[model samples]
Target chain A: EDKVVQSPLSLVVHEGDTVTLNCSYEVTNFRSLLWYKQEKKAPTFLFMLTSSGIEKKSGRLSSILDKKELFSILNITATQTGDSAVYLCAHLNDYKLSFGAGTTVTVRA
Target chain B: DAGITQSPRYKITETGRQVTLMCHQTWSHSYMFWYRQDLGHGLRLIYYSAAADITDKGEVPDGYVVSRSKTENFPLTLESATRSQTSVYFCASSERYGGRDGYTFGSGTRLTVV
Candidate 1:
């Protein structure tokens, strides 16, 4: 079975703080790893990492995949209230996605 | 209007009753999928269709049924609702199966079984 595990199940921090989320996966025929931010309804796309060492960044959020270690990390710098949400880590394997329990981050004002 | 949509944003039903969740996409994507989301489980695939009349089971397909007679529509039917079946269901569409671009998801339907 494909397994994806995320660390720091929950976190609370004030605005302007930097937080790092972790995700590790083990699966065959791995295609990519995707991150989704879930607030209330369906999750919205965040980032997709496919290569190792290469980083994908958007604004204050950045993510990198380490294929050799079978892990990935998402970093948020200068967090804001809007960044408070459940961060999901999903592995794309054989055209299917296996997701982790997710890290719930709460940004306090 | 241009994205995927799921009907009945919220529903409440009794156990053993039949319930159907509808999904429609205007993108004309070749691939469609149904997923259930719970607190502990982020998202689990229930069923997927590659095209019209072509459907397959996913990780959690039991107690559920799906049909894709039209390219833009894929409806998931639960023959008999159970208490454990209560969860938020999402519908997603993709131009290709597991394309690098990823899938586009609907707003989701929240189901409550009593």
Candidate 2:
């Protein structure tokens, strides 16, 4: 069975703090890893990491995949109140996606 | 523009009843998927369609049936609703299958079973 696990199920941080969320996976025919940010509604895409050691960045958020270690990490620097949400990580196989439990982040002022 | 939309954002059904959740996307993507999100579980795939007339089962599809008669529409029907099936259902579409690109998801539908 394909499985994905995320660390730090929940976190509380103040604004301007830096946080790192971890995701590890075990699946057959590994393809890519994706990150999403979910608020109250649907989840929105954040980053997609395919190659190892190569990082994908968007503003204060960035992610990198370590295929050899079978894991990935999402880094948020100088976090803001808007960054308080659930960060989801998914491992992609052929056409299926296995997601982790997600890390719920709460950013305080 | 509505990239993806799910109907009946919230619904309540009884066990043994049949319920169908609708998903529609205007992107004409080649891949569409149905997933259920629970409190503990982030997201679990129930079904996915590669294209029109081609549908496949995902991790959880025993009680669910899906049809893709049109590329833009993929609907999931629960033959018999159960308490365990109560969760938030999300529809997603991607330009291609098994690629690095991310998926576009709908707002989601919350279902409750009694």
Query: Judged by DockQ, which candidate is best?
Result: 2
Residue B83 deviation, candidate 2, in Å? 0.9
Q: What CAPRI class is candidate 2? A: high
Candidate 2, after superposition: displacement of residue B1 in Å?
Answer: 3.3
Model 2: what is its DockQ? 0.85
Q: Give, for candidate 1 chain B, the lowest lDDT window spanning 10 residues.
A: B95-104
What tens digits encode model 2's per-residue C-alpha lDDT throughout A42-106? 99999988899999899999999999999999999999999999999998888788899999999
TM-score of 2: 0.97
Off by over 4 Å in 2: none
lDDT of 1 by residue, B4-109 (tens): 9999899999999999999999989999989899988889999998899999999999999999999999999999999999999999988886656777789999
Interface RMS deviation of candidate 1: 1.3
Q: TM-score of predicted model 1?
A: 0.98
**Model 1, global lDDT:** 0.92
RMSD of 2: 1.0
* Per-model lDDT: 0.92, 0.93
